[model samples]
Target: MQVNKRPYGYEEQTMFAIMAQILLIGFGLVNTGWTQTDFFPEETQLKTAFTNTPIEVCGRVVDQNGFPIENCIVCLTCGVATSTRADGTFILSNAIRSNQLLTVTALGFYPEIIPVELYLPTNRLAVELPPIILWPSNGNVIRFLFGGDTAFARRMLDPLERAARNEFPIENPDALISVSNPLPGTLRVVSYVKPFFLYVDYPIINFESVVTLDPSTPHWEKDYVYFTLPGSLPAIKTLNIDYVGLGNNHVYDYLESG
Candidate 1:
């Protein structure tokens, strides 16, 4: 180092100032490319460290033996993660499109990443190495027919009451055939009185509560009369008339029960 010899006054001070300025300029060149504005331009700040387009991923994990791996943790770089269940399945929701790297890791297995395709949904994914497999969920539709209340009727109308009572058979033949029950089985015919047994001889001209005595040809008398149904119910019809019910409730004593 050499000392500058100058008068110890303004001249010496000026010499020291000039040397100091030269040293500062040399140091600036070593540290940075000296510029008046700044050593570096203004740094660009990242407004957001994330993306807007969200991604949805679903994947299945399995062991090396080709069996499902349950309760395995799955993670991604975009702060989205989930775990596999007993069926070795996991779903990653609300992930950014930029974060296509899906990290799948299972216990006692190697961690792996996969790229998300542009048009493919992560619903069904298969991993064949270190062994991992995926499958689609099973969906099915079902149909059921609902009608008739048998148990309710059976419970309300007890067995004892059902036995003692007589129900009018389904009056609507179409209803009986279509709704009640198919009627291709054996038919039950019932009638209160047979054709020959109906009391058709009670005449209004004869004395009430007494039969007039005709000693000559009693059975040949034509004075007796009674009304019968005009013709008959269609003979082709199968009637199921119970005699027990007919014998008990007889308000018309004029009509005899067969």
Candidate 2:
């Protein structure tokens, strides 16, 4: 029996075919930029794992009340989002900047973003966060008007009907609002609050001026500041100033007295 050795080119042709197929596959992988998890698990973990960051956190989710909210999703920076246990307990460990915000989002609850340092400190501290109250998002979302930085210097407003109005799509809004330093004046500044209140659900203004006879001054920077009288404050309710916003700028106007 003679051994057959007739194919000289066949071996080289087979090897070349195999090499061509491999080259095609390599080019495809290069274009797509896919990592091989089987070969290098550590590198893949480094790229995709949010848990690898150096902050450890645990917290409970609750309503406005003290009751625990089950199955709420708590999320943090670096994509470290997770679901809470039945007891509203959640744990996450990853390193994100203290200045970054931690977001806790859930269905039927308003998404809230608090500073990451509030929960997980940038100093790599482990913290058990206080139960966060999830505000309801699914109720009747009434759109109300809110204005900022309004300082009415004893000025009466023109009527909404006569004062060339912009055609707003004011449907059934919950309220109309003007905020920060609009005090009720001697000439019926509250007149403005009533018509808007009659048209909508409620009309609200933030009375920044103190209804007081006290002449003590916190206005060290300027002598031009004035406070409304106590008698005038009754006009605040009489004209239907439905709500008041006591923000920092208003409260700081008279310092502790304010």
Candidate 3:
């Protein structure tokens, strides 16, 4: 290593130094031996030697039926918060050995908190937490209807119309929803969704655009994307969509406008 470095020019040495500094700065924002960041809290206040320890605090979240819960928010009282992936898996690497509480919350289910002790060693340890089950909080059991990605689906109108007529059940639903689409056009195809949106208690959708007028530059992203006309949101307001989660890849499609 010394022999190779001896032949390197000043530019190469300078680049390595900059990279090293960047790495330290990156880690500093999360956790370090001296200070703790809000998003990555440590339990102990001890000033230990600087460690490059790769600790793992991993866990899964599920419903009472043992089915996995997606998009659950898991937060530790120590400061860090992580969301479970589609399969209900999450890992908190900056976890310090602490005797504190870990809170788990989801949209429809009741929130739960569990006691935790996250300890770190010289070597890496995969500390897996227990499966957190979220039961329904409200006594009134609700039936929810869900639909998939509607970005390019101009054919979604018929089903949405059925859902609105209650012909899908003729029975009123507790909640009916669609996800991850921004209303850009006149929406002649899915105007049926408006009625279902107005009827349900939790009128929710995953909005994936800046939801504005005055068109912005096309996103350089190499994936499927869409932006809603600001005028289109009036349709949303008419439907009374109560909640939105920016959990899709294209939420950043408009860059700063996003």
Candidate with the greatest lDDT versus the true structure: 3
Candidate with better lDDT, 2 vs 3: 3
- Listed in order, each prediction's TM-score against the native is 0.27, 0.34, 0.34
Model with the higher lDDT, candidate 1 or 2:
2
Stretches of model 1 off by over 4 angstroms after superposition: 1-53, 118-258
Q: Write the per-residue lDDT of candidate 2 for residues 173-192, one digit (tens) a residue.
A: 12221222223243255553
lDDT of 1 at 94: 72
Looking at model 3, residue 114 earns an lDDT score of 74
Error of 2 at 50 (Å): 17
lDDT tens per residue, model 1, 80-191 = 7888888887777776555244566655454445555423233323222233543222223221222111011211213233221123122243321211332231121112
Q: How far is candidate 2 from the true structure (C-alpha RMSD, Å)?
A: 21.5
Worst 10 residues of 1 by lDDT: 203-212
* Candidate 3 deviant stretches above 4 angstroms: 1-47, 50-54, 140-258
- Give candidate 2 regions above 4 Å deviation: 1-53, 118-124, 140-258
Decreasing lDDT order of the candidates: 3, 2, 1
Candidate 3 local lDDT, 3-65, one digit each (tens) = 554688899999998888779878775344555555523533222432434355789999888
1 against 2, candidate with superior TM-score? 2
